[model samples]
Target: MKWTDINNIAIALMDLYPDINPQYVRFTDLYQWVIKLNEFDDEPKRSSEKILEAIQLAWIKDAD
Candidate 1:
């Protein structure tokens, strides 16, 4: 997917899951994950999973 597409998806995800800190997720990472989601043909579910994973990792680091 294009950068703009990935960005839009990320923004939507942020709105849907406010508990996730958008700052901790880099645009490049989101783009890469978007590509993976497309490749796997599970874009929505995988994208949501990736966002949750990123949020979990960020929270873990914050606690450290």
Candidate 2:
């Protein structure tokens, strides 16, 4: 995945979890993770995992 893709994911994440700390998982981290995944030939899987994790985390927080 590219930086633009990760950035778009970050924006959606932020919208879903507005009260969460972006500092803990910023767009930069997502971009870097995508780059790292590219090295392992697991970019798509890793990206989907991260996005799902973000969504789950947001939902958990909302329930609390």
> Each model's C-alpha lDDT?
0.48, 0.48
Q: What tens-digit string does per-residue lDDT give for candidate 1 at 1-64? A: 4332434445445544467565566646644545554323334434455555554454445434
Q: For model 1, what is the error of residue 64's alpha carbon versus the real structure, in angstroms, after optimal superposition?
A: 21
Please write out the lDDT profile of model 2 over residues 1-64, one tens digit for every residue.
3423444444555555567665466545544544454223434434554564564455345435
Which ten-residue region of model 1 has the weakest summed lDDT? 37-46
All candidates' TM-scores? 0.29, 0.34
* Winning model by TM-score: 2
Total colliding residue pairs, candidate 2:
0
Task: Enumerate clash totals for all models, in the order shown.
Answer: 0, 0
